[model samples]
Target: MDSAPARHTGQNGTGPAGGGALAPVHPAAARRSATAIHPPRGPRADQARFALRPRRVHRRGRALPLFTADALAAVVTATTLPAVAPPVLSVAPVLLAALHAQAGLYRPRLAPSALLELPVLAGRSAVLWCSVAAVTAAADPARAMGWSALLTAVCLQVVLACAGRGLVNELQRRAAVRRPASALVVGPGAGASAVAAALHGRPEFGLRPVGLADTAAPAEGAGGALPLLATHEDIRRAVIQNSVGHAVFTRPPEADERTASLVRLFHDHGCRLWLADPAGTAKVTGMRLPHPADQLWGYSVQPLLPRPTRPLERWAKRGIDTVLALIALVAAAPVMGACALAVRVWDGPGVIFRQERVGLYGRPFTLLKFRTLRADAHEAATRWTVAGDRGMSPVGSFLRKSSLDELPQLWNVVRGDMALVGPRPERPFFVAKFSTVHPGYEARHRMPVGITGLAQINGLRGDTSIEDRARFDNHYIDTWSLWQDLWILARTAASFFRFRLGGS
Candidate 1:
């Protein structure tokens, strides 16, 4: 009657409460409890954690408020612009702002959600503007707003919306700094340490280290008093006790079932579970966790490949490139003419240098540029020119430094062989060699070569490390968008002027 002291049955065994009679424990539960109680060795334990959680989610502060404020400002600016009736303009901006806010255009992180929201925002703005125009026309036949006014309103709304968001962002950044979300990383040994170091170093993301949870005894005592919580039949209790919102598994778990069970249990309890991808560890960059659902639910996560160019996008890009290339060719024609004269006067006859380079899809093409080397230079020589190379003629040095030598590549852009902005094409000899050297080298050829690229503007021109250049190229391929292309072009302009002035 003072009876059993409330014995509890765990996965591995039954624990007696105050020396009470032992209760029968299920065989599977007993085994699990035993295994959990006795932590595995380093490598095995790390493998177990990796098997369980393969992806990691890094949480940063929300950008919703900033987005909302920016949208509101955009609305206000559009509504107050001249030539538009205040009422009509006012309604459109609010609706547009709401659409953009709902679309999450202002999120601090650029996830798929933000990308998906862009078109939705643009479409909603279009519809709202069209509706306003239709209603206004119906109401006032004589005072109907012209197309210019409507267009002006649309442009002003977008500009102001972005500007407003930017201003609010600066203010928010100044007001109070919030710390990064705390992560509870669980793994074998050194792997866990790596995760902790990465998170600690990147405080901009606001991740604060609460503590580490591992199966094996950590080499460093669990930073004094932050218990190395035991793992028994179930990890759910341990996770909850620690109030861990995110669980990063740095190594695979011992059993697939255990991994699956952990994922389900943590997810059910409102915790985000992540597993480290094996392929990610090989790179210097830390492990990349795929989209959350992909990791937890076992979905395929592949790098996005180039699709057949969209008609509208293709035409738009082509038109812009052609028009600009032509204009540039014209404007620089005099300078080019002068350069040609200078080259002939300073060195010799051939005013252009045409080299065989690889183009889209590994196809070979001739890239034309103003001759920046002596005509008598040996054809067999393929060495990359560095600063003060003896091969460069006097005019060639000035042209190469100013990038005026690159003007003729506009012809390549005009032709189908190149794009205005893409990975810079390399010579065929180097291409074959690099392809074998770098595994992801072929990926760059997916897009047509360019006059200037993400690499070039970043000061990754001649003689820079091939590995670093490829990384930037890969990044461009991975994150390409129309806006990004435009940004690159703008940056290229600023860089051109700056370099020209500095005679770089």
Candidate 2:
């Protein structure tokens, strides 16, 4: 499972041309560098539950200008256009906050140039003021502002916004010179230690090294300012304990399956993942190098991976799930009742079958389904397949093929235990088994488990390739969207009674 060719090697070798491949790093002895790093050991993980540090107030403090500018603009709006309601002015700040957040203005930069972001600021300002003008006009015709007033509002917002942000950036730069965001350096060997040393020695780049995640945890721990974190759990505890906001990797986080697990782990904890390339050779699309080499102490990094589900989008997904699930539950009640009666008649009792299934973050929840097999709870959870079982009644088989047995799951959806469309939930045994054998398997838990999923629609049910099902589930998660969810729902509806359920 170890993919790094040069374990504990400090030197990151250049890869072949035209392909974004990195050659295996040379082992520590091969390159005689001052920062000759080798993997190291750490304290026992069980005893490493350190208390989390108090988070930095300066991070939000750095983005204070964006809020200030909007507040100041609202004041200007009140004085310039007296007809604009106080409530409208109050809402402007919230609008501005969302707009700036989407514009990535509030995102921290290593060495941000306020002037360099003028275009983004200008565009956001225009949009904000234009929206305000339209709202003001719609609210009251008499207070309708002319083009000049709109232009003045935009000009004032842009200038004041830029100046305020510029001041904040300067303060951040000064803070970077003093105290900066805590960081976790990932990967093994010399390159990682060197990056940690540079970051530890120079705080101006805004990264304070706290620990290292040495995937290859060497028994002879490397001697450096940082102690090697022996495992992913240690790294998680380290991140929380140190209030780490940044994760800098000396090599690709996806080089090995275990390393890739660390990537998902980092994402789950909301750390900004970066790849350190001193040679300035690491370039992937949609990445920003932020600062010059000198400013970063010769360290250049690019975002190595996509961010996890954003909080707002996540909330929105939940909101959609709740609304749709509630309606579905109400509409499906009759069908559910009929199915329950049938299950009662066919199976004698316990019309609704509740089986423990793995859900988001590997948590277990009771999944509701009309009984499709004459088996006890233990048998239901432990057995992987019962479709062709001799004990299956004729009604059970018909109910399953029609998917009417799944109607009771609408309540699960309404209870927020599952989504209408997501990676299908599985029993804990399989989750444990697949997570160990398949690298991409656990990633499916990022989103909520669903009643129907991409894997199901593609006929990856019963006895199908677990690897292929995991891939499809991960692909659905990676490309998840509201539109896609709607499309999947449509597809599921189109073939509602087509599949003879088994292989799931």
lDDT of 1 by residue, 273-369 (tens): 4443222332222122233212211111222212323568767877888888889889988988888889888878788888787766566788888
Error of 2 at 161 (Å): 2.1
Q: After superposition on all CA atoms, how large is the RMSD of candidate 1? A: 20.5
Q: In TM-score terms, which candidate is top?
A: 2
What lDDT, from 0 to 1, does candidate 1 have? Answer: 0.54
Candidate 2 local Cα displacement, residue 36, angstroms: 20
Query: Candidate 2, clashing residue pairs?
Result: 10-190, 10-191, 40-221, 461-503, 462-503, 462-504
Worst 10 residues of 2 by lDDT: 1-10
Q: What TM-scores do the predictions have?
A: 0.42, 0.57
lDDT digits (tens) for residues 54-123 of candidate 2 = 2332243456665676567656655665555677667777787888787767655565666887887788
